[model samples]
Target: QWDKPLTSKVTSYLEDAKEFVPFKLKEVESAELINKNNIKTVEWVEAASDEEEALPDTSHRQEVTITFIDNSMLSGTLVSDTPRELSRLSDCLNTKESFIHITNGERHIHVNKNMLLRVTGS
Candidate 1:
């Protein structure tokens, strides 16, 4: 499992490509490396390097609840290499990015940054 080495790309809001889908290097580069099309936003998900391990490390992940502009809520994990405070998190959100990737184990969800109201960690 996870031996083929693949990346996931969501083509539309309702359509999602499987993480194990085989894609040509050019397609991966075009969709992931460079946003040439400008129509789709690609997020890369790397396979867990340690295949023998049953659980992946969660030390660098933060449990977060994201509130949207419409008052909707989403709970997921925010992966960060270094420790982060609320102030730092707020600053990053102020940059007006296009999407925020919320990962949950082997899956992830991309939320439009413009639609987010705030992110709270626990």
Candidate 2:
């Protein structure tokens, strides 16, 4: 029951929003309140794509493992297409948004940069 179109990307939905948002968990079968600080990583298994034009040009895909303050790890692929995101993964991580979006095949993960202690590439 979101106001936005189904085609909108999760990254876009999270951008410029409030500190907390409603997130549905299929495993638990309920929507939970998610704050930027509390969320270490939001992962989507077999994630679907939105509109192609809304997505990055995606010339490169690199695998990255992120470690949080609590020592939890979530590994996913980081895609870079634009010039700003092209130079390095850190550049992409430095976006205005608090979440860093990464993908691997059908898997997509958004890591909270603020909660991350380190990010290693593989």
- Residues 20-112 of candidate 2: C-alpha lDDT, one tens digit per residue: 788875788878887767876666665344433334454466688888888987777776554743557777666577777787666667777
The 10-residue segment with the lowest total lDDT in model 1: 5-14
Predictions: Cα RMSD each: 9.3, 4.2
> Which segments of model 1 are wrong by more than 4 Å?
1-60, 80-87
The local distance difference test score of model 2 is: 0.67
Each model's backbone clash number:
0, 0
Best by lDDT: 2
Tens digits of per-residue lDDT for model 1, 6-115: 32223232133322333347545543333222322234454576244322353256678988777888888764333345335554455433555567666656666666
